[model samples]
Target: MAHAKVKRLPVVDHVGMLQGIVSRADLLKVFLRDDDEIAEEVRREVVAYLFAAPVSAVRVDVRNGVVTLTGHARDTSLVPMAARLVRAVEGVVDVEFELMRSEGPAEPMAAPANGGENLSRA
Candidate 1:
């Protein structure tokens, strides 16, 4: 039906019992929502709940079902995770990230008794 561009189809089990009807409009309805609503869901579901990112750590913007995420995350790995979560949100057409990884504490450098220049500093 999808390849044929059929708008509606009936669902049945192996027994051919008419379970329900699926329509393109019904499918689309799941993915359609106001931009602000989508943004809120992304922020609540992805940033805060799924990724455990601070609500302020990531900014979510939705426009025409497209989501834009900007800000920094403590873990770089969360960047992709956040994207995936946002994509799962209903009404999200796409996701873009302008996020930076928050740097952890710097490791202390070993110093030589010779007092040589610290090449690692540069």
Candidate 2:
């Protein structure tokens, strides 16, 4: 199976699943409230592992304790590998992945114009 990049989906608690209620806005709020620099650092670490594994078909974003991964991998079987990579990172409380299979070449990831540098000292 070809590897594809995946995006992180919103995670729901066991109770929320029973209720069929959970919102993306709520997840976003949780992400935004996280320590910015710490989140970024975790993201970087996750990305490093992903790339080093030779699974370059993915992107990572961290907000609060939630981690979102988006991209394509060469092997479908590598999806769990991606998740495991994020989980191994320190301070990650949740892992969400949104990976899709593609028949075509991978698209270029949008780079933040400012390099997403932290303005405040840690």
Candidate 3:
């Protein structure tokens, strides 16, 4: 409705049956949410559920319904998917990413014979 600048929309059921009508006011009422609420939803729903990662893995910061995501993830492919899911959340104004690819696991590097710290770069 807001996208088309229309005031009302026809509500439909699963079978495409007209259930009722939805006005712009109704949509606003449903979509309006606090910034913290939006951030929690994004963290719980998008990052934790969709990505199957702990909430700590992704840093979610929301201001005025705009979300900014940072931190690391093992699967970088899910970054775009996370963004889409965040956008789908109600009351989210926009999504931004500063996420870094996570190093899957730590490995011990071969030490020099001098018994010193490894100074060689990968």
Candidate 4:
């Protein structure tokens, strides 16, 4: 009800954050963010955090809201972590990576304590 120029919106907080907005259009607004904006966010939020420039040259590319990470990193084991974080970014529809080991052999990521129920073959 707070939308538009409606002054003094007649809104009620029934459960105090319990009955929050549950609109499908609001949820679908995630895809409205541009690819370039998503790419920059991924580079700053994910790539810069997981793969630094000194050790890794990973490039962030976004197309149609799908983020694609390319290039090799020194710590290939962090691929899973990267994938997880990248998918957490807003406006990310999907994630696709073409990463490889920069030096040594790529090692599998450590299994989670919960048996890696959410883990993928990244």
Candidate 5:
């Protein structure tokens, strides 16, 4: 007599706020494992694109399917552009922009008039 082989199935945790029982297959469909990797790639691509753009001082954060952008830029118009770029990413479901205009100039500091004097010296 020959014995049959048993195949193992994927396990998923369905414990959440929602009521009802969920199986491994159902959970897998609802929460795809590849989603995070895809989202991360999208985030990196968006960040690279934004950094390459003329606009400076732009930050990006991606969680789940939402992308949050917070930072200041010289041109106000660039704020919308940043949001649009993130939204265009494949895995991004939505984009939230909290970008604000820079309060003041970002010019480089000028050297002290005194020759190589330490201002912090007591």
Candidate 6:
């Protein structure tokens, strides 16, 4: 848009037919996302997938565009991975963690059917 010096851009379909128009303000609106909405995505996408219940419990808090994760994690070392995922979330300007390392070795949610005990982290 800066190179073209256009405040508004037109959207077109496959055949080059006009669909809609997008403005600079429209593209910038993503940063205006609500805090609660951002928190929910962190919980669903990052927390639920990385830290499951019973073994781990994570709390998500969002203010402005920063996200803070608190509570316990089976492997606190995964904080870097979690931060990367959380930063990928839209409207999340930054990510922070206050996770405590969960005691004991990380294990799978369910025992394998093979009848052999194995250690796993997901």
TM-score, cand. 5 vs. native: 0.43
State the lDDT of candidate 6 residue by residue for 4-50, as single tens digits: 89999999999999999999999888799999999987776677666
RMSD list, candidates in order: 15.0, 15.5, 14.1, 8.8, 17.7, 8.4
Q: Estimate each model's TM-score.
A: 0.66, 0.42, 0.63, 0.66, 0.43, 0.66
lDDT by residue (12-111, candidate 2, tens digit) is 6777664344455554553454546545664455444333333355666666667777776544455576566556544567788786665554344333
lDDT of 3 by residue, 25-77 (tens): 88676357888898876766666654454458778999888899988777777
User: All models: lDDT?
Assistant: 0.69, 0.53, 0.71, 0.70, 0.51, 0.76
Q: Give the C-alpha miss distance for residue 103 in model 6, angstroms.
A: 0.9
Q: What is the lDDT of residue 111 in candidate 6?
A: 29
Clashing residue pairs, backbone N/CA/C < 3 A, model 1: none
TM-score of model 2 (CA atoms): 0.42
Clashing residue pairs in all predictions, respectively, total 0, 21, 0, 0, 0, 0
Q: Residue 71 of model 6: what lDDT?
A: 88
- Once superposed on the true structure, which residue ranges of model 1 sit more than 4 Å away at CA? 1-7, 12-18, 50-54, 105-122
Model 6 TM-score is 0.66
Q: After superposition, how far is residue 119 of candidate 3 from its true place, in Å?
A: 46
Indicate which candidate wins on lDDT. 6
How many clashing residue pairs, candidate 5? 0
lDDT winner between candidates 5 and 6: 6
In model 2, the runs with Cα more than 4 Å from the true position are: 1-45, 48-57, 104-122
Rate residue 11 of model 3 by lDDT: 89
Alpha carbon lDDT at 35, candidate 3: 89
* Candidate 4 backbone clash number: 0
Model 5 lDDT per residue over 1-122, tens place: 01333233343458544455545555345334354664554334544343333223666666676767667744455556556655655555778878676755443323333431322221
Give residue 7's error in model 5 in angstroms: 23
Provide the lDDT at 102 for model 4: 84
The better candidate by lDDT, 2 or 4, is: 4
